[model samples]
Target chain A: MAHSEDVDHTSHGQSMGLLRVLGPAHVWALGVGIVLVGEYMGWNFAVGKGGAYAALIACWFAGVLYSCVAMIDSEVTSTVAAAGGQYTQAKHIIGPLMAFNVGLYLVFAYTMLEAGNAITLGFLVDTVAGMTGHEGGLDQRPFIVLAIMFLAWLNYRGVLATLTFNLVITAIAFSAIIVMFLATSPLLGAGEMLHKDLMSGQASLPYGWLGILAAMHFGLWYYLGIEGTTQAAEEVRSPARSLPFGTLAGIMTLLIAATLTWYVCSGLLPWEYLGDGVNGAVAPLFSAAQISGSNALVWLLGIGTLFATLASANGCINDASRAWFSMGRDHYLPAWFGAVHPVYRTPYRAIIFLVPIALIFALGAPLDQVITFSILSGLLGYTFMPINMIMFRKKWPLDTIKRGYEHPLHPLPAISLMALCSVTYFAVFLGYGTQLIAMIGFYIVVSLWFHFWRYRFVKRADQFTMPWPRPRGY
Target chain B: MMDTWNYIEYGAWALSALFGLLIVIDWIKIDTTYSEEALTSSREGELEAMTEKHRLEG
Candidate 1:
């Protein structure tokens, strides 16, 4: 059987490898930091879609989908043990054409998300300034630019420090959510939250099962980037142990956080206020705090919102640059992007290159459009997993290969993931039919571009680095 | 006192510009100092070349 584990290389010389400074804690921080921002704000938009009940259903549904994803990802990533996450999986399990597409998915998804988080960081600053009854609105551009450039600089310096910083802020943001739930626990006991009243009246599912499906779209916010933990596979001290623990732990954290967020927000906010329109929630948790009449809670939630946004942006920069750097290393893009800083042992060039691209995304696109693009790109990437899993097992059967962490109920997790993805894709279509089509066209064009021109630069035979036996038949 | 936020707004822009400039300078310096192969080639690349012939072709 072919054994798979990350080769821990001791430095023969001073300047050779990515510094394996990360532990499972850093891995958890990267995943949770990127996702806790959702609980602070965007997931509430699902309430706007199908009402509070629908949002709750969607949250749990999303939990199932992402749980399956984390399990399958742990299995594949533990074996692949590379930087690009799903992109690397696609390259080895599938082919170059699929890898190019999946690579674009990770790059675009994380880049757009980074941009969105930076943009939200600016908005958070604006909202805080507005709360103080400031004279005029600050230009969000400078704040957005500052956040992106600063995080990019952090990423360029080193991975260890960047993710350690993420750990601190992500934990703080997560704490605020827990505090919010506890603060409102009294109201729930006193029957003051009006949840029962609202559900009986209008807070019930308006669009029925269709609404729940629609809510699944925004429901994605709960754990959108938890899968990103796998992106740091190469840097982990022990990919075998850390990848499974961090990823599964990250998903579990998100599930708890998502449920608490839904419960608190639904109970606290009025039924009418919960899902006002197709585009819902300016800042739902902050709004919920205001309704609770606790200045302290409001401030805490506001600070939480800001920290979550910053953490998300920081994590996004870390992941996006890694994906881009891995692709460059494989010669999918210019080789310059593959360069590691001889001193810091970070992907300095890719980190710098993605700054302007993220800046463009942050400054130019509308938040809704940016978010939709990111989520759609992510959903498309999720679709590729089942195929990869099936192909992986077929290529190297269980008896022939030694996987680091083999997922149980092999075909079951893959099937559940595909079914969830199909539903989520439908949910996206219900709201963003036109955008969905456009995203497909965008990827199709990029795939063709890579196949025709970029393939020449890619060192095809050298790209397969895994030490495994040949396919069962081939 | 005038709204202090205005100062912060301007400072943010200045800081952003400075960071961008620094990254560019560092990028240029690194480019000048190292050859492309030196930057791109790593222990990982060496491993890829040594093992596992590319089976899943484009």
Candidate 2:
């Protein structure tokens, strides 16, 4: 039997790899930090497909789905306590093939989200400049490149610095949303925001129930990256305890923030206006602040939106790098990708390689396409969770491993999550047929390359061991 | 009717503000000492010892 002791650690040039310094607060920061921007933007597109009320229902459904998934994730992550998040958990339960695909899909999802943030940030800067009567706004390409580079550099510093920065910025971003909501409360009586003509607009729900299904993809934006926090399992101080506390807390925060944001934005602007193309999608909150004629609130919303973008991009880099690092460590990817910076003790190589790819995607794709692609990839990767949970229960039996937290409804929650993921995956496919096909083709090509080319290299290389210390007498 | 709806929106905003305040307070009260390098090294040592014992048993 190849025990963990026999596995090599020096292939990556780091002896102890990825210092464990994060606590529940840091985890909460990461959990909320990563998904904070979602509360700010990308969610209004749902208003386009399903009017405000339908979008709100979709948001509630997504919230319930996430709440269930978070509970199960807390249980699984606390037990596994690995860096790869779903990818690593899938590895222990499913085979290496599923792990490889899931890992790549996760990296793609995070990178695409990072790209989406960069693009959205560019739009926001342009919007602000346009509003202020500035000449031409900053060029999107150069701005996105610079932003991705800056975030990658911040991540390279260390996880502590990353989380600390995340905490401060996340607080500011959340404050901005609250301020927007409070400022917009008095303006709600002026417009028919609640009972708007839903079917009059071009982007109206033409396909009826199918349109609501399509809206589910955009609705998912409210809680899209909440699961990404589990990727910090390795760095956290006590994975079993802190992971659950942080994840649950983060979910609650997101739910409250999402509800407030949707309620305010929908009530402040007509659903038809909120659902229009790019400007329509992002203008609700800013327009709301403008309604109060408070320049300070407008500036706050602008600055807060920028910080929210930064937080999302920065957090995605952290997640994508760690997932890539784990794959490299396992020899599923090249050993070079697994290399940690000797000084920073961070996965510097993975972070560097991923930024250019994110920049390329950001420069090429529009916001809605980028968001749709990310949602599809993320949901595809999430499909593994329920299966993994069922397989784990059967493999280890409950009492075998030291469990940090347990889900209330054993297989039921896992089953429900699986059903939700499946339905959502199909919904995304039906809504984004061409884009989904393209993504599926990309996955197939990557999987084929992994099997033929990557598997050989991994077999040739010595097996890499888990870097974290395991419990005694395993 | 509009007044009722406006009050409800105001109530939601107030609740959101309360939640945000609590989160900020928790963040402020959190102990940063655990993340210090010295403490991290100490914990790593302890974990290393525990894992070494497991390796020996295996």
Candidate 3:
């Protein structure tokens, strides 16, 4: 008969499959994929509007949040070094069930995120088809389900398949953005740059700093995927070194790319010529095409947006599955979720579980609400990430595990991330009340109930270590 | 129109190729691996030891 220790150790071993799948380059790719998601999330929504500057400022605030969260993520992944990924890190300090609830929320966020991107893809396809004189229009729900299934098949096939698919498409997507810049720049002389509708009006000023801060929700939604590299910790070679470097490198590259892309596109056409009242997701790119009189440019943008949205789905599936696998490894979820395909050596169970649920969501849910809700949940999850990091340092003074990098101003980054997230959370509530209330209510109820249930699990296994003490040496 | 499009396409390709060459050259020139390799090995050793303890206890 095997000892309990033996069984537990064996369980942990299976979850450690993360290291086998990710490796250094794949880890870097995951980071790059994350930034690509962020760029799509932020860049797709606004272009050639008076609020473009305001939105850019909001994006910068999100960039600050990104830098801070990156630090917090590196610390957690290094210290915990568990397959549970984010949730495992939470459970180690808070309790198992709290971690489980976090996992639930994250899964919810990523699945709906697939739907969101699919919805965006749906619009891109419809517009392009309209431009080409294709009739009867592609049904969005069916297309969304198709996208979810296509991504599921890729992820289910293996990590290499998923990464290759994303890598090729993402490269094309980035190139399309560059092409958009070049083609659109000549349109500046065609019309007036500033339109009256660009302004939110002086009357809107009463909303004040609070209102401006609330805008962070949209910005935070854009920046949610920065720490995606850590999910593949076990797959990556030398995660301790690669995780921080890769995360920062990908983020910096995105910042440069996004800044250039936004500036070029926004400047090419005047704020007035672009539809001010319309919440055209890929409207700016289209307007640029319209002025340039280039059908090819519009086609280029349409294809790029579709690929970008697909890449988002592909990336989300990979990260979300890994989260479940990690949770299963930690014994917080069913054992099957942690199981690796003996041949593929991938978390096949988790992939299977995620795909069906994701398909259900894509087929059944409203696309707009799914996208916005995913953004809000992602922001909430990221906010929790830093808090977990701060707690880890306090309770477990693991000096040896500190990364090559640390936040320059310590608590300042943590505090800033929290404040930024808080603003976004409130704004999400204000802008999207029904979704926010439903999600938050779900989180609170689930968290409290899980706490009581997990108490028994804790008593049987790990002790409830109290508030952690501050370390003296830096 | 075809001629103009071709020129633009070729110009972009040339720029991309040049950038790729530069990146390769820079990678060859830079010594990214520090002597901290030794320090890293030792630190990893310590972590393994700690994880080993937790594994045994849990």
Candidate whose DockQ is highest:
1
Model 3 DockQ (Cα-based): 0.02
Q: Candidate 2 on A1-474: residue-level lDDT in tens?
A: 221311233232225467789999888888888898887777888888777766787798889889887887898888767678888787766777788999988898899999999888777755655665655444445456666766777787689899889888988988888877765565643333443444355434544776677778777888998898889988888888999999999999899888988877776667777766465656566665665577898788777778888988888999999999888777788765665554456776677778678978998877777777788888887777788878777766666676788878778888888888877877777778898888889889988898888888664323323333322333
Model 1: reference contacts kept, as a fraction: 0.48
iRMS per model in Å? 9.4, 15.6, 16.4
What is the per-residue lDDT of model 3 for residues A6-86, given as tens digits with 9 covering 90 to 100?
345455542223324454556556656645654544443432222455456666777777878877777667544444457
Best by lDDT: 1
Off by over 4 Å in 1: A1-15, A187-192, A276-280, B43-58
Q: What share of the true interface contacts does each candidate keep?
A: 0.48, 0.00, 0.00
Q: For residues B1-58, could you state the per-residue lDDT of candidate 2 as single tens digits?
A: 2433344335544553554344334323321312222111211123433564788889
lDDT of each: 0.84, 0.74, 0.60
The CA lDDT at A469 in model 3 is 37
lDDT of 1 by residue, A250-325 (tens): 9999999999888888887864576652234567777888888888989899888889999999998899888898
- For each candidate, the DockQ is 0.30, 0.02, 0.02
Query: Where is model 2 chain A poorest over a 10-residue stretch in terms of lDDT?
Result: A1-10
* lDDT of model number 3: 0.60
Candidate 1 TM-score, C-alpha based: 0.93
Candidate 2 deviation (Cα RMSD) = 11.1
